[model samples]
Target chain A: MEGNVKLITDDGLRLDGRSSNEMRPIKLQTGVIEKADGSAYIEWGANKVVVAVYVREAYPKHAQNMDRAIVKARYSMAGFSVEERKRPGPDRRTMEISKVISEALSSAIILEKLPRAEVDVFIEVLQADAGTRIASLTASSVAIADAGVPMRDLVVGCTAGKAGGKIVLDLSKDEDNYGEADIPMAILPRTGKVVLLQIDGDVSPEEFDEATSMIVNAMKDISKIQRDALMKTYSIEGGE
Target chain B: MKYLETKEIVYPGDRIEINDLRPRNGIYEDDSQYFSEYFGVIQKSEKFIDIAPFNSPYLPRVNDKVIGKIMDIGPTMWTVDINSPYYSLLHINDTPWHVNAGDLTRYLAAGDFIYARISVSNEIKESWVSMRDTGMRKLEKGQVILVKPPKVPRVIGKGGNMINLIKSETDTKIIVGQNGFIWIDGEPDNVNIAINAIKMVEREAHTVGLTDRMGEYFKKLKGGN
Candidate 1:
């Protein structure tokens, strides 16, 4: 409604020239940081995120859990990651994202095996697009795996939204700003179990279901890319 | 009876296709099915299936020989950094010396290294190391290097062949700890060669015929020298 702007073109293509069911290109790499126990870098659309994982004895002694290891995910964005030159350090938004991410990742990791230990996940967003939370979560999973932490499964995530009365996969910056609804979802690919899900704006039950299904399907492909990236790190050449 | 090809790379949650064999380290069971728990290579044996992870934090276990650096000396015990998530304790009574309780530092001070066996480990990861066993004592003269714990076996090689080769070739006394700490003692030059060879083994532990490759590598080094 702002100056007759249209999120979807008359040809059914989104502003980024993507189809309704098309997602942004994604690239994942593991072992990017030499000093971290495990590390990964991801480039999804215009989002660039790096994740590092460290497993150590739980500190502050009181925080130690006798039954399992605790996950602490810190999601931070650089000052130059956004167009507005955001301030660095943890804000309310980042703290919320970190909390949800920590809970989601805790479900995938085998915490019981590492009693009294803590797995720390540091997610740094060097660049930001629209769906940075999902990108960071995806990269964090790979980093945790790279650290050789036992996990039930790799977590993959995607975003879907309703733009111009049509549900679209992977909203870009512009679409996210003006879209009718946005739904970001993450899941454990092995069991198809939803781990992290958030819905913003208004959508009917039918539209929500459609968006979830779209995100889940896109996540399957993303999951394969994660596996391939990890395999690439340990591929044997000319070895029996 | 083998199932999937041995040494196949796998990821966490990847379903292992095998029958009758039980799961071992790096594997977990879920609803009667077994899945890998680490991003590692699969190893299948006649009776068990295991995963060898590329990298992981060391977990202390009872009876595991470990190389530790003394971190803090208390009245009755010395806390040690054993390259694990959990720090282990060495009680004054567990040491070879019969020293007074208040004089722990007199026997083993902070910053000294020791070779000991884990005497007690609990579900919560609290562990105590002991130096009472034979061949377990303070490591006085050596340079310590750390590698991934999973690669310890490769450094030891089949029946100690690789380690013995390294020891004799470089003329260095070496001790490999299950906790991924290695102690090397000899001429500085020989120690350097031993360190390089051990690092190479850590880097290519997954590759086959590593012993043969290491033999050729040593031959080339000696020929060049």
Candidate 2:
């Protein structure tokens, strides 16, 4: 959407040649770990995430306990997750991303059963592109299931950003660099609860509304992908 | 009407009707009547939240069996480290005891693994425990075979259906802890078969109607029985 790239052209198409609201390709896998309660791997366009979940003893903090169990997340971008290498531990950006992801998951799980128990979700970004947060959240949900933490519905998180002042769903790396605004949301595909919501950059009330609408619509398609990944892992998808 | 008035009472982030400004902006604390789902200190505004002793999931449930290693021995209680969020205390009275009144070390001792059912788990809201169930016992050799911790539930199945089938077909004694460590004892060949079966069920439990196939595999194994 900036130098050497056009958000959209004379033909009304994006630089990636998709429509205004079109998203990139997504590939998902669940239950790759042999030890964690749950684990999953996901690839969205060029971004990749490996998430592991462990449900064990609850946090000892007297204040953190909830009527239901709680979900704690540690999201770290792997050293090689980008064109340029990142450090091993989390950066402030990754920490903020982790908080957003945990909040998204907390809304989807039926945590009351564990009472004081805790579910720890760890996400390591093997590769990253424009939509890493959305991809990480998506993979983490599958890993949470692999961890066997019960939930009423799976949480699906994604984003639709306003690029060059126009709404485009699922930003690519270059597009993110030049995008004017971005909004990432976590949705309960079943109940339509917007569990997590975040926005950055400049947008009017009207632009925000338009972008939100696009993200809500996109959840249905992404939800189907989520279900498909579950089926593939559980052997429920026509495996003998 | 009081609820509406309370809502109208100014908190930093209270949602108000676009024009409902009575100018009651007070510094925010837990002073209002409306209850929050969880607690947090107001960072900047009512809308911005960050709770302290920040919530991390830890709860206990009925029928949950976890893997724990013995850490210490108190005068009358076995201090067990559950390697989880919760700490477990096993009283001498809580076991299938066959020992003298105060000689605590020999009968159960430390560093030994035992399989016990969660007879009491009000852990989220209360402290309660028990080791009084048919499944409760001091685990024995043939060793514990562990799969991924989260895969334990799939291996055990609903109402112990998966575990019972493995026990009956292989003619082995297997105790599966909710923590994911499973103790098995019987013929070596049978032990191997049970372990393989458990892994098979785990790898495919996410499949729709696939447990039926697992049952079929067991039926063939039980043909001569």
Candidate 3:
């Protein structure tokens, strides 16, 4: 995809004018929707994702786990989310993302505490640039907390990739398109254990270590924002 | 056991260090790390640590006073929505008087609201409601307002201080359902005042000095109106 295009300037800044260590500005708010048990709206750069958490009776009579709860995550992109209007419904990419997101969420949740119940997380991406999956996963964790489900920890997602032969913390749309290796990872913030990992391009062992370290560092900051958003929603002074 | 600071907001995965600090509702212990399972403020006591969730769904329990709307009238029972996930059954046997099973609407019709008590709830969350000798009756000529169920206890205040104050000052009759439904009946203006006051309580339930704040709020509302 490189055709005499400059992915990085002479000043070591990316095309979006952000340093390799910097990430897009993130804004997270919880309890945005009334009906759902928990809801959050997130704006990370140009990507906008809203997540709603619902707790209901487990269905189909047999999917019910007698000793633990089931988590179902649905990830969808709006028709206008991308440059080309995407058709609605579960595409193959979305189905795969949904499965991974669900698994990542269950990693942090203490599902055994919620016996015979189902925690459903619905993530809708209204606008997308890049890293929409990570943004939605981060917001969905907040929605889970907002829903008051018992959990062991909050899950945080961040992406780091190799651009211009350098590992950057968060990739922009252009960086993602032109980057050699894109790694998206989710972690349990408390334990620092990686729960979800996906690599789009190739990277060496040394590059993988550097990329994961960068994402782990970025996750600490994003996790703080998630906790702050929940606190602000329930704080006495911030109470609505 | 020790406890966290009152009114401190806690999130999932936050560490709690006290060895004897047993976690209670909305708080859980995993290994040696105690964390909050919900997004809520800490409600700590010497006995245990509990977190009051900011917002939660209404789950029916036996002996709970509730306000419900009749959704459908079956042959021998009426299905009522108590703002819970499951529909509560109001049987004819629990009604004030015995009416024939075929024409059940003669006692209570669909879309009608009533104040009742949950008599029984099995393990599966199916609850049966009763109106017999519980001061329960059809709610007529009132405004039904919904708030978060967790805020109900706060609106009631210590020994019902907040609700009683609102009732006396506003000169309104209010029935608070544990399931987050409120029935207010009074002069139009007084009812409006009570409704606003309740909303304020629901919004600022965890804050201190709420009773005094509500008193001033009511005074200002009356003076302004």
Candidate 4:
């Protein structure tokens, strides 16, 4: 579907008239919702995700028990969010994504520090285009930071897709639909750990290498933006 | 009103491009031209005047007096829904005296009247506020009428004219929430009149001669006072 879009002309310039590999615009805000302990809303390209982190008092749940705190992640999109309406509820696909995200984020948290407590992370995708899961996880990490619960590293969620015979760092809504394969990963920059990994469509091993490197570089920029947003909120050392 | 063109305008939660700065608070600015009546504030820099539109301005700062409600709370912190893009946090640690974060229930309950000051704000707008100071006490004894969030200025009027009228009529304390929840503690009749008055203003917030209609209605309520 994205291939049919006039985003790319014969010259290969994409929609919004950017060259290949350029990402869409992103606008993020932390603690948007008052009710949630930690809340953030991010508009990455066309994908809009609202992430809330609840740092409740420690409680025991068999499935969540670990040496550290349990970071439970839920990723879902609203039914009327997309162009085509989607039915609500945790379908099989969403459950799989949730499991992967929780696994990815658990590596970044100092869970051993929170033995009995459960950190419930909720990610609601108000609008989705191509990279909802990645945006959700990225915003969720910022929400956790906004809540002031300590974490080992900041996570950057990015999707690398093979399109037009090239690996793109951030895929727009249109490119996503037409791209060959979308590899969404949650990367812990410090540890160089890949937490959540999922792919749709086809990619060669060499292309995977290009995509991973592209995603990591892009994530550094994303992390700066996240830190900027948080620093601006708290008016930390360099904020005005 | 005159406009100021600048490089960056500080919005409530974020920043807009430098070129879009108009000195109006309620106006939207974009490239190519300017529209009338949108308010903007001109900040004089070394070489250029920074034009900041009124729409997206900064959140509450420390010692800056603003009103909000107790939306939710943690063991030691109560969240205030300030009339800005970001939420405000009031911590129990910043209180007047020793108060345990775990036992923060009795100090402030949910839905109670709160007028606070921003003690700290983060890039995420994770603000920490304090009610330990004087004049930041709990509100009581009045009927609250909810209005739309953006219509606050209209109901309160420029320089408190609208709210002043209500206070003149009923001698009640009115606490307005940025989230469209207003707490008005007043007599039964005044409360009804005030609610209807807010609804009318919200409907006609953009129309002409609202001052006249509001004055006439208040006169009728006062029997030509």
Per-residue CA lDDT of model 3 for A1-240, tens digit only, reads 566667888999988889988999999999899878889999999999999998876887698777778999999999999999899999999999999999999988888766666889999999999999999999999998877677878899999999888889888888898878899999998778889999999899999999999888888799889988987765544322
Better of 2 and 3 by lDDT: 3
Ranked by DockQ, the better of candidates 1 and 2 is 1
Candidate 4 lDDT over residue span A62-165, tens digit each: 65444556778988879978998888999997898788878877876656544545678898888888888888888887787666454556688888887666
| Highest lDDT against the true fold, candidate | 1
Write model 4 residue lDDT over B138-201, tens digit each, in one string: 6666655555344566677888887787667666667664445577766777677677777776
lDDT of 2 by residue, A1-240 (tens): 246556667887887798988878888887688667668888898888888888765656673566767888888887887887787886899989888888888876656656666778988888888778888888887676545454555678778887766888887776678878888888776457788888888888998898888988888788778767754543323333
Chain A TM-score of candidate 2 vs. true chain A = 0.91
The window of 10 residues in a row where model 3 chain B has the poorest summed lDDT is B1-10
Per-residue C-alpha lDDT of model 1 across residues B148-220, encoded as one tens digit per residue? 8999999999999999999999999999999999999999999999999999888788877789989999999
Can you write out model 2's per-residue Cα lDDT over B1-225, one digit (the tens) per residue?
111100111211222232222212122222332221221122223443322101123344566776555667777777665544566777777778755556778866777777775556553544334566676666657767665544566688878887887888889988776655678889998998898898887655433354577788878776846
Candidate with the larger lDDT of 1 and 3: 1
Candidate DockQ scores, in order: 0.50, 0.12, 0.38, 0.02
**Model 4 ranges off by over 4 Å:** A1-8, A57-66, A236-240, B1-225
Measured with C-alpha atoms, the lDDT of residue B85 in candidate 4 is: 37
Stretches of candidate 3 off by over 4 Å are A1-4, A58-68, A112-116, A235-240, B1-6, B18-21, B99-102, B122-124
Off by over 4 Å in 1: A1-3, A236-240, B1-6
User: Can you write out model 3's per-residue Cα lDDT over B102-152, one digit (the tens) per residue?
Assistant: 789988899899999999986657689999955899999989999888899
Q: C-alpha displacement of B81 in model 3, angstroms?
A: 2.4
